[model samples]
Target chain A: MPPRPRRSYDQFCAAARALDAVGDRWTLLIVRELLLGPRRYTDLHADLPGVSTDVLASRLKDLEQSGLATRRRLPPPAAAYVYELTGRGRELTPVLRALAAWGAPELAERRPTDAVRAHWFALPLLDAVALEEGLVELSLEEGDFHVRRGSDGTVSYGDGPAPDEPDARMTLDAGTAVELGRGTLSVADGVRGGRIAVTGDGPLAKALRDG
Target chain B: MPPRPRRSYDQFCAAARALDAVGDRWTLLIVRELLLGPRRYTDLHADLPGVSTDVLASRLKDLEQSGLATRRRLPPPAAAYVYELTGRGRELTPVLRALAAWGAPELAERRPTDAVRAHWFALPLLDAVALEEGLVELSLEEGDFHVRRGSDGTVSYGDGPAPDEPDARMTLDAGTAVELGRGTLSVADGVRGGRIAVTGDGPLAKALRDG
Candidate 1:
């Protein structure tokens, strides 16, 4: 493919240089999606609703050019293309986390015109959950999702139900979920106050309830 | 002023929301400028070269609408209009700092076409300086500028020479300056190794050399 034009601020400042790479509209949001794991083009298109096909393609190309993401094809039975972050791209985790924390208060109230998806809550809640190594199924009015903290210290979340029986299931109202995600309320406070109903007999469930 | 259209990823995620506000090109760069202090429209334009008049005006309006910045008139003798970051906008310091630290590696080499202003180094170097409460004049090969750590703990920098006799003056090459700003080289290390020459007899200079 021909290289798309490279847009830059052209300043020597580090922050300006960083912005030159990932500061465009929907670029970081695309990063947010890829951060979950590799996703097929269709998967990304579906998750990121309202993004025009052109913009998505352009941003993905930009990411590839910037060495933040790459396009790869699966082998054998799953011979499909997917986009994933590069090691340099994965380094954006902290930058995304910082932005997520800073913009948490903005999520206190959702606008009527706003569009939300199940996994949109994943990043913030990932930091809120204390499970060392377990799959956590979360149920909210918006939708159902699951969070997993691996023994290897990697955390990831997905939409809908857990692929397997979860170690813990948390059912809570949207308000409580928003507060917890905003970090205004702790998991212990929610569990003790009965805002979040924790279920399952696993150690993760027991630890959450004991909090 | 009329409200410009607000572009959003429409996702409920906090990072997405932040990108909604600051994800636009030149927005965070403008935020970086305001972090230094308030400035007139002309001043911002001068520092931020290559930004079209229309885009700059549009971004300033976007910032004002987002409550990140505001415009106000100065008193009497110099009754010029200036833009400054609101308290909420100032909260982006950490966000900018994170981006700066992450993007520091990208600044390893200056592109031939890169445009740089003296004050561009101010923000990154702000965190590198060890002055508790004094004015620090930094002389780089690009140009000279000053950073001040006020008694109130507020830090600010300006282009050109110090406004008054500065408390301390340090002269260094652009490479060492970039390393120090990137946090790879410590101030003490720079001083001890003579990469940075500490020149003033003030307490700030004494402390810097003792390191």
Candidate 2:
């Protein structure tokens, strides 16, 4: 890409330059949707209802100009265009995650849902540093799941296979796993309370309880 | 504030919530500006030369509603007002700094300064976790500055009278510091070559050079 003219150092004193690029309300949200993966224009429109078609087009154009997003055609004869993040746009993920973490509590208070409740646990995964420290093994049985804790407090998933050296194993459905990650329930507490079952090493069970 | 009505799980989504709030281009920029300090409407307008008054006003309103910014009257005449970040708004400072760091190189290449350059260093002080380790003490004398490194590299600055125990003390004007930070000159090489001077503890001075 040809370089654009440099703005004066004094120009850096103002926040406008950054804001002008992503300051608009719709643009970042559009960027956020794209982060989950790419989607066609119609998918975006459906996802962001109440946004006028013209405004969406304009925001997308502005995003493209700012080097945040780009559009590409998909499929045969469909001419369906999808927008995806460029490298610059992906950089905003941490910002979006931080904002979400800050707002999550307030949002949960206002809208109590099974999914919203689950999000409380899962959202922290966005912080890879924290995730690497905390996660242990996850194991699934016929309808139950087990969680084992490592000495370092990392949780892992172990299930179903012929691995004799297992930490803690539980059996649960996929939805339950998703919900547990989302923070909907305390997996350790659930097992202790008999809402779930655990069949594994005692230390691992205790660690899961502690976690 | 009264509790808000229950929202659906989808509403808790970050992008959905952000769009429900500032979702336009100008509001985030407005938040960014306030982070440096508060500014009056006219000052903000000046900073964002391209944004029309109507759009600016709309963005301000959106920001106010989102709890990211608060507009306050500056005494005497209620007609005049300044916009400042709320606590929630100030949380975005790191995000803004990261974005600035990512964008700075590209911006510098495109727009080289024409006049005498002023150097500015904005390391994140409150959060040590955000910065890389390195402590260098700098002192100015006769339009030149000297740097000395310590055993532990924890960067800090003090604006008081000099202590008797400084490892090394070199002096230079602000412009030179700015230039060095921008990679225009190597601090170690400059000192060794006598383009810059070094006095006091040689090991500390050498460490600063290494840094």
Interface RMSD of each: 1.4, 6.1
Q: Model 1, range A45-147, lDDT digits (tens) per residue?
A: 9888889999999999999999999999999799999999999998887788788877888887688777887777777777777466899998888889898
TM-score of the first chain alone, every candidate: 0.88, 0.54
What does chain B score (TM) in every candidate?
A: 0.89, 0.51
Best by lDDT: 1
Interface RMSD of 1: 1.4
Scored by Cα lDDT, where does model 2 land? 0.50
TM agreement with the true structure for every prediction = 0.86, 0.52
Clashing pairs in 1: none
Return the TM-score for candidate 2, rounded to 2 decimals.
Answer: 0.52
Model 2 DockQ, alpha carbons vs. true complex: 0.17
